[model samples]
Target: MNILFVHGNYPAQFVHLAKALAADGHRVVFLTGRKDPEVWPLTGVEVRRFELHREVSSEIHPYLIPMEQAVLQGQAVLRVLDVLAQEGFQPRLTFAHGGNGLSLFIRHLFPETRLIAYMEWWFRDETSHWCFPSYEFDQRLRTTMRNSIILQELEQCDVAVTPTSWQQQQFPKHYKDKIKVIFDGVDTSFFCPTPVKGELILNGLKCVQPLHIGENSLLLTYATRGMETLRGFPEFMRMLPPLLEALPNLEVVIAGDDRCVYSQAPDRADGSWKQALLEELGNRLDLGRVHFTGSLMYGEYQQMLNRSDLHVYFTRSYVTSWGLFQAAACGASLMVNRDPATNYVLKGDQAYWVDLDDPQHLVDCATKVLKSAPERRKNIKQSYLKSEWALGNCIASWVELINAQLKV
Candidate 1:
């Protein structure tokens, strides 16, 4: 089958799926923004750059910025699709990330093409408007207008795939029947426990160690883009002081790029709310004990997970993080913030649940897992490995779903 994958970044969610489909001899081509020219070299996938006039702006209203960016990018995508059509390049199926407007135009251009959108999230109740508080006054009024536009695009798709049932449930009642849940697979082979592994010697402290019987060192890790308030960053920071006071041996690692995504420029002031959090933590920051390894490479990330005694994943909403799945695959016992969306992915004894609103609960839940008996920890880790959450199995299932849909 000839497949055209569309996203702002090539192969973002379709990383493994694109490779899998290419290996099976399907023709895979990607249309993405003008960054990272060599993203998928070995997948036998071809990339077409979509050039847009404007960069994503942070000064304008946050809501308007992404919308304007998407429309501009969509125009670029349409131009590329037009060239492809002129060259007689027609795909049997089209897969796109729904947030972008490219798919809507693609459906109009190629009415016969079967379209499937990977629905990451949709704004429903007031809870979905967490990004900006000021936007709340006009959020529902704006969201209703935006939802109409969004639904028009989504309704054109033949099918919709979501990473979790929680995300699928976010769609309107009419679209719920069309949504299918498939995980964004993790690389289990790379994430598993490695014996005799030396501690991650970061900033002079040997914090990470392999699981050795009777070893009581507690390693806790939290990773993401940065310390964004909506991502529970402020709460994590608020909880840190109390946690540090309670557990002396506990070593915490915060990983990710410190730079704010929506910041105007690189040299801008660093006195954001996130920076203030770091300042307040002050002497208790424990440079040697609490490491901040900013934005690690994939291999280093896996190693960090492998070395963790417990992984704490906190999010204000239902958006699932690939890092959490990777940590679970690495056999690190996970303590996740409780949400309806998270409950769909993590279940039974697979993870310890915590309330997102309660900072003390986050610390307590993580501490409980950290202080658990070695045998109990080992059992939870092993159970996580065997669960449906494994990356390899998840990838296989995604391939099967795509293949079945394309066959129709």
Candidate 2:
């Protein structure tokens, strides 16, 4: 069987499942626009690349810019498909990400192939957006227009899959029947809590000497891909002043880049939200206790999680970060902002929840979690993810879905 995986980035959501399918004796080909294909270490799978042939027109309306870019990307994907078709490689099934316009033309080219879309998000009117101005005509117009490619994929694909129930809920009610909620599983084994072999060394990027984990020091970790509004960094930052002031021994390790990957840019002319917060909170923020390690490597990240006395993961009504699960896997006590309705990583008594409107509540929760007993801090070992969102189980689920789709 020939299986194809398509995404803008290489080995993203399909990282674990792609390798699993390849090991199952199926020929797996991953088509991506990732700049560096060799960065990923995939043994059995083949990686292919495509580049956009044309640039988006500057003359077009700003609202249509995304749609235009996606159309060009669809053209690029079609060209690659034509070459693959020439090589007599007709994929039995194609798993393509729905966000990018890459999957737009797959159904048109391969009529018989089962094109399953991995729909991460479905943009609608501004009401669907969390922080964006819902009443503004332009924001609402752009929001509705952003779903052009996604709606196309939803209309064309055999089945669409979302990682979380929240993500699935974002789509239109009429198309709800066609969507499936399948979590992109986590590798619990690597992320699990085991004693770090030696001293935890956070490789210093800004500082001269590497920061080693102190035995007596307490770590309150806030880990994310980017320190943006999407992951509730500002709220986390606001809590820090009061938190560090209250707990003298506690040190907050913020692990991520200071860039806007998901959310809109800051209103500040400098365009950095972190900087904006620093200016806003001026002397209130405790600079000494706050450690900003700009994007720790995977090993350092896991070690940070392991050393965390309490992990803080706060976000708006958006997709939950993978760090949330990693923190859980590492057995660190959680301080989540969102409710149980969206955040399935931690349940009742397993973690702490705080309100978005109440800044003091966030500080209060952090202070309490840090003050709690060490034994009481760690939670939810191999039970939850092991049964549900573990890598093996999710792979099995993908196989089951594929088998059902292909009918043996």
In terms of lDDT, which candidate is strongest? 2
lDDT per residue for candidate 1 within 1-408, as digits (tens), equals: 788888887667878877777888988888887488584564588888788866876686654654666677677888899998998888888888887676767866778888888888787655555655455556666555556546756888888888877777777888887888887776767777654254564431122543221235567778877566556676776766666667777777777766543212222277355566777788776655566666666766776676677777777664767777777667666777776646666566778887888767777776677666345544434425445656777887777776787688
**In angstroms, how far off is 275's CA in candidate 2?**
1.5
Clashes of each: 0, 0
Please report the TM-score between candidate 2 and the true structure: 0.92
TM-score of 1: 0.84
lDDT of 1: 0.70
lDDT by residue (tens digit), candidate 2, 137-201: 77778777888878888888898888877778878899888898888887887888766544567
Q: Native-vs-model 2 lDDT?
A: 0.79
Q: After TM-score superposition, what is the CA distance of residue 65 in candidate 1 from its true location, in Å? A: 5.9
Segments of candidate 2 deviating more than 4 angstroms: 124-127, 131-135, 196-199, 204-208, 340-343, 373-386
Which whole-number lDDT from 0 to 100 does residue 54 have in model 2?
Answer: 73
Instruction: Tell me the lDDT of model 1 at 126.
Output: 51
Q: Per-residue lDDT for 133 in model 1?
A: 45
